[model samples]
Target: MIVAQRHRPSSSISDDFETQGEKSFLRFLTCGSVDDGKSTLIGRLLYDSSHIFDDQLAALERDSARHGTIDGDFDFALLLDGLEAEREQGITIDVAYRFFDTEKRKFIVADTPGHEEYTRNMATGASTADLAVLLVDARRGVLSQTRRHSIIASLLGIRHVILAVNKIDLVGYDERTFDEIASHYREFAKNLDFITAVPIPISARFGDNVIHRSTNMPWYQGPTVLEHLENVPVDDAYIDSPFRFPVQYVSRTDRDFRGLAGQVASGKIAVGEPVVVANSGKLSRVREIVSMDGPLEEAREGQAVTLVLDDQLDVSRGNILAAPDAPPQVGDQFQAHIIWFDHEPLIPGRSYILRTECDSVTASVTNLKHTIDIHNFSQIAANTLAMNEFGVCTFGLQSPIAFDPFRSNRVTGNFILIDRYTNATVGAGMIDFALRRARNIHWQALDVSKSSRADLMNQKPAVIWLTGLSGSGKSTIANTLERVLHASGRHTILLDGDNVRHGLNRDLGFTNADRVENIRRIAEVAKLMVDAGLIVIVSVISPFRSERQLARELMGSGEFVEVFVDTPLEECVRRDPKGLYKRALAGDIRNFTGVDSPYEAPETPELRLQTIEAQPEALAMRIQEYVERRT
Candidate 1:
């Protein structure tokens, strides 16, 4: 065995450690797929680095003899995973953390789970890690799960990655095998956000190139894993970033002393610098920065302090103090990426509580753009999100929130979705950016509101959307309903599909994308008419449930109703008034509903009437009666 080196110069590790007997700390994590030797590598690091006590080593040797993965030898994985279940199953379920010190530096390591079902646990560990040590099994090369964890590590803003090809002995320590695996990973990592990547060949089981250099691989000459870990630079980019302080609590112990207590999230704040309360746009000057020991002249990021302002203001929890010259974006709409955690699927139009940096707001996911395929980072169209799924979505908040992009500031950009009824955290999100329209278009204050206009007209404004198959008597019923509504002294307007197609939607075709656009235009027009205090009736074959739901969400609650005319396809074909159904059936036209294309019926409609059983006049009166009750 090689003896320990006589001197480990602190200068080789960092220039800052030149004057210190005690060293700075490094936080890192070990992550990869199952059976990739994450726990074993960390255990080996602790053992060979001389950080373990004699008693602990004795117990580890005894345990290894009793229960080892390999026959008649010590098992290092048992050191980190000490639970009975983990020893029995030989798989990690929860994150394991350990703290150790070396001659050059002090370190804390988090050993994360490798199973696909425990990705959230891995994410939780990676959130606070400054570096990631990604392991790969030499026998299996690279797997899909390996790429998945790498993508997540990049998304969490980890800049430095050390790719460790563990179990190199199993592959005969072949130099060609290591080079091929490293090349494949480097090529695939081109699109990721990592700053630097270094590959190291090590055998965790036999301690080859782990704590000391290995002789088996004579073709490779590089620093060992421990040597690399001791010298990698810790990210200090947040020091130059703009200052941000999110107030956590108000410390008002006495009438004369009131201060905001929180940690400085970014940059540096001086005692006399001007700061702005981001939520209310109020300005103030920093009077004092008080720590537990005494007052400080300035505070940098990560220092907890009680800030006293120059003027007395109504400050409370969830308020943010930021640099006046460059404040964070404040808006109610944002484009974000979310990782769903709950078993129940996400409802696009339902309300949930979104919490970020001690602030909570009522929020709804207004639109789902797509779900990502983690294998290749491809986008697939989706209407809902399920458990363990990643999606790109847009959210509408009840009030404005202050934040930066997640890539810039994780403290201000990350949020969690809480189930309103169960109080469970159901999803996690990272803000990509604030929607530009939400920032530019401010709500213009008006003296006359929609309610005031409706009051003057002596009726409630609403949209009665009539949808069904083609030639289902939707227009006939709409005509009768308009006549009935007008004779009752109510102002109304009918927006038929043919009239809309002739002018506004004339450019659209019968394709799915065109249908979505057609419904979007109609919804916007109907919203404007409702604002004018008119009862708008829309008659069309809006087949897609997603578009219909979009129209409902565009209006205020209870201001829109869906009425389905349930006429069988056979009956509609027999009474083909427009002859479009015959052409659709004969394959003369493509994307024809009920023939080639599919129609997603409404799960719950306000009214479903069998048009064959009753005349158009009777059905129209039935709708009128329901409208009168609702109004």
Candidate 2:
């Protein structure tokens, strides 16, 4: 759950209310285990601050009556328990977002669930938080769950911690109870790399020093929780930090004008300042700061604004804008801390679509270093990360990318792994360090033309990519074609979906995305082999047409042949060559393609085989004949 750190501190507050009513806001989240009273604490803050409306209060009163409470006393927990299950179980389940304003600033509080099951949701909530409020029960003190929460918060880049020792009333409001809990929290927090921490004792139910002064706790002398939140001196929000503006959207209001639109994640930006894009590392200058209303002289960090550049650049979504003074490195490899959220574990060597602020690239996990034990913050050797597990790993991107460390800038450093087939986000990664030095193998480009390579290999460097349901004889026909070509003195290579995996694609699996990357790597290797003057035969159950199109693009027209082994799904399931179809039908597998996934059949193919009735040699001769005509 370690996330990107760093924020731009506000240098000066604007007092011009009439011309520009720009108000700064701080976002924070509260998270912990169940029975931690996070909802109660939030409700107390809102109620004591008088932020609730009259009608809302009346509804709350009615709800309290339904719950069998007399006198309609404020059920502080009612403010955040919006879900039916939450009210019934009296436990928070989802990340409930609430907004309230104070005289000093605007606040957005994300009340996230405390259950270990919902750790991913909690990480999502705290990903955007500038600070975190961690609650500890005086009786339980700092338990294992407490340690887990603190570790996650710290790893998520929420540097500031305000530990609230709730239910002090049960502890006799004793100073000893308060001190003991505080001491334990301090010791646990010391192991984490936190910026600042403050522990305070209060009874959330009795409203002791939450917002107003508590006469019951006369022994404690310090500012109330609200006071500390309001007046705590935050460093320059982003002025001193490196500039990072992730281009979220491109705006072109008129045919004559164009601009890049996104929020400034960190640092300040001014007109004519030189900027570099992380994708291409191309430098440019800021021509104007385009706001919603009009142009601005300057745009500070955290402000969502459009930027007009002096030069036409290849800037797009998933790209970052940085100051020229210290540009970020553009590379394809890096080490990162990943919080895996999907039910399917991460597969090493399988390429996924890695997306950050404005840049997206096909990347693969090169290695999994180790996972951190949440309760202890100790490293444990793990092959794959399951749901809510935090691990350090190295990744290999397809293209070079420039990025700052998550500790330096949160916006440009955070990334999500998307399944190319399912489009589901599988993992959240924070760039720990970009490993620029990776081993590279250089292949000598022959002076022979591509067509010459095809001739030298005796067959054209073309990809006969076979795809169909399992047990479709895709492998049988492809193997037959390879032998016939060899007898004809035509050099060819057959990349069977399962066979090449032993060496070329050994690190991938059968998930939707992994399958796509499986085919992608095969296609890439096929292209290279095609360049080396060998006709490539690839047999895989590439169910998606989009992936086939990608393969086609990689090899170019007339090179990539989509050969449909048109076998019906029902027939293949009946065949059950690998027993996968039987398992899928038996409900042992959930995301099995051709059953759970919709396999898009090719509308057009270079060749089509209805069945394996034709002899393998006959099929091979037919493919060779087709190749001869094309060449």
Candidate 3:
């Protein structure tokens, strides 16, 4: 029988772990299919290593009897599955992080959930892990989720992996079972760019070969899990790579003490070393490296220090300071691997907030290259990515950002896509490389600007966007509004939805993804019309609020006026002039807004025209009056 090791004083452990000396530390996560014993393995490690306190052990014993899955025995998984729901369901949900140390090295282990629904949480755990401990059930050789987690780990830059073949005792500790499973996994992980894939057979429930050698598996002659974890070389090569420092804050503690405050993401920086602001390409020299302890001569990777510059350059937050000769790439377009996390499919042309280390910008997936098939690792053509789907796509940003390829620098290349309206993280992406068009294309300077064109036309250029359910009198109101503006000597253009679709968007469909692209194209044309000094009127269903918000952002402040033609769905069905409502109701049409698809009504439209409240002409006059007042 295996016995728990003796415990060390908590104070000494804390001091040893927190000390910033030359001790090596490793960050790893355990992941696999559900019920593969990730939590049990972590708990066993914590328990057998004597990291559990007396109160915690006692609580585990009491809680095991209440929520135990091991027939009232000591359920090791109870230690890590802290959530009540997790305990009741006997599953891991959120990533549970725990820290422990042996005499050899300190470790931070993340026990990630194995459920397919929580793959995003697993990805989050892998994002910061240097090594991955992928668990697999002995009965099942390699599952789809196993391949998926492995791919995600590779994408997140984790090169070292330990294939822990768990539950060997359940399969009678057969050497053939272990060998076949390990062989299959190694073959599957061949293309993942893993530097090392070590396979170890262990029964986490019995604590066999977890912290000590197992007599039950005498045929398996290999180092135990703890031995491998303690001996594996921690990769610290980022310190030797190119220097990169993303300025998080500009310290202006009085004018005499101006400094750029941020952590050095990679490489070493010494005083008097020439650095360049990546986006602006302005050159300066590092005057001082100030740390909390005092001024330092040099700072390496992972060091938080304030850098005082020799020159008063135009630098601020969200700017990258890099070595003068090896500055990062600055571009507005790039190709990246995206792991979509939102329930709503990732729609191209729909804008999202792209947040990197210290920078935020409006970005959209311009094109979806293809999605990876987890079952066979094949590339399949797809226009949109669903939840937990992996795809390669081209992204277009509103402004240029400085970044390196993820392969060379994970810190600078990683970013997350946030839903602009909900402020929820929808996707995680890693930059592969910048697109050639980003470097080739440049905006030409024109002496005559939008203001000059509007002044010449003697009118304030704007886009009057009319959105509502289909069959709602949006087109009629837009036509009347444009007519009135034209009669008032305002240069005006009307872009009816059907008219534009007949030409500009002829190839587009009514799917959610297509609708996003349709609106994006119309918004761009409307922006161009406004730039030409014309008042552009757009009449479309424009269903999704996110797409409408995207249109609003493309225009100048107050230049995009949303006019909601508030017509009831019953009224829209009653006035089904185009026979669309009939077809949609009869199941002949799909993805029709107000029928099958969703139409997110404007929350705070500039003008809400209730068809029941007034006639079309009167509503048109109301919009005209509003625009005139704004002018």
Best by TM-score: 3
lDDT of 3 by residue, 1-631 (tens): 2233555444565675566466688999999999999999998898888888767777878887888888746788888999999998989999999988888788999999999889889988998898999999999979988999999999999999999999999999999999999999988888898888999999999889999999998898888999999988887859999899999999988969999999999999999899999999999899999999999999999999999999999999999999988899999999999999889999998999999999999999999999998777899999899998999999999998999999999899999999998899999999999987837667899888999999999999999999999988999899989888889999999999999999999999988999999999999999999988889999999998898998898899989999999999999999899999999999999999999999999999999989975788899999999999988
Compared to the true structure, candidate 1 yields what TM-score? Answer: 0.69
Q: Alpha-carbon error at 497 in model 2, in Å?
A: 6.6
Q: How many residue pairs collide in each prediction?
A: 0, 18, 0
1-631: candidate 1 lDDT, tens digit per residue: 2222222233343433354575867889999999999999998898777556556666777777776686665588988888778888888888999877777787889999898878788887887788899999988877887887888788777888999999999999999999999998998887888887788999998899988899999988977888888898885658888999999999987999999999998998999999999988999999999999899999999899999999887788988899999899888899998888787667675567899987999887878899988767889998678877788999999888898899999888888898765687888889999986646666789899998899888999999999988888999999999999999988899999889999999998877666766887898899999998999999989887766876887788898989998888888889999998999889888988777877777779999989987999999999999999987
- TM-scores across all candidates? 0.69, 0.77, 0.95
Model 1 pairs whose backbones collide: none
Any residue pairs clashing in model 3, and if so which? none
lDDT of 2 by residue, 1-631 (tens): 1111221122212322333344456788887768778888888888777666655666667666665222436667778888888888777888999877676877789998888767777888988887788888888888766777787778768878888888888888889988888887787788887888888787887788788777888898987778777765555556778788888888888997899999988888999889988667789999999888788988888889999999999888878888877777677789999988787678665557898777788887888889988666789997677777789999998777778888787777788899765788888889998885744755567678788866655555677888887788889888888887777787888889889789877987666656767777877888888878778888988877656776787786778778888877777877788899888888998768788876888888888877645565676567778887887
Provide the global lDDT of candidate 1 against the true structure. Answer: 0.85
After superposing candidate 2, which stretches have Cα over 4 Å from the reference? 1-25, 66-72, 83-89, 138-145, 169-180, 213-223, 278-284, 438-452, 455-478, 481-491, 496-524, 533-535, 538-631
**lDDT of candidates 1 onward, in order:** 0.85, 0.79, 0.92
